[model samples]
Target: MLKAIIMLILGLSVLAAGFITLKRELSIEAFSISSADEAKSEMKNIFNDQRWFYLSGIALFMQFVFQGFHLTFEYFFYAFLISSGIQSLFYLFNKKELDYKVCGVIIVSFLVIYL
Candidate 1:
């Protein structure tokens, strides 16, 4: 029972962080391009940008490290939550999209909570 409560708190905290990251990402200025070609060009430019790659790499690396370890459900739950929070921090600081990262965090959180 105590473990369950702790898991709930950790999960909620991570989810909240993910939401904040999403909010920050959405709050950024939307790009405006008159033509599809121009938009594609701009998007490509953004996609190839080093900052995005670095952020994504860090997030992925953290996920790998968290998942690779053999941990109890409670530990995994707490570690994932903390990792998600860190990822959210990365997004918040770097202005990167949260998207699937948030989803991954939520799914793992629930799995750990119920398991």
Candidate 2:
């Protein structure tokens, strides 16, 4: 019972985080678009922003949901792992700096898998 509650909370939190991040990155302007041109511009900006955070948040939330339901969740974890790995590589390749947060995600993911 406790585990299920925790899992539900975690899932909701992740989903909320994704929405909050998207809100922060785009601001209210994202919701105030008045034309197709403005919408397209916002879409482009969103795509170029820290999109991986929200994407991975969704994946993690799904994993938690699956676990709560006593269903398979490994696929969601793998999805998160692959996306996080790619995002971290992009950080390294583009900025010539390792994204420690993403690296941490990768490490946690591996630990989750093995342990």
Per-model TM against the reference? 0.34, 0.40
Q: Who wins the TM-score comparison?
A: 2
Q: Whole-model Cα lDDT per candidate? A: 0.56, 0.54
Name the 10 consecutive residues with the lowest summed lDDT in model 2.
Answer: 89-98
Query: What would the per-residue lDDT of candidate 1 be over residues 1-115, giving only the tens digit for each residue?
Result: 7656655665566677778858978999986789999989888985774543443344444444556644455453465454555455545556455565545554544454455
Instruction: Give me the runs in candidate 2 sitting further than 4 Å from their true place.
Output: 1-12, 18-36, 49-73, 81-98
Residue-wise lDDT of candidate 2 within 49-83, one digit each (tens)?
56576547645654555446443566565546545
* Each model's Cα RMSD: 8.9, 8.8
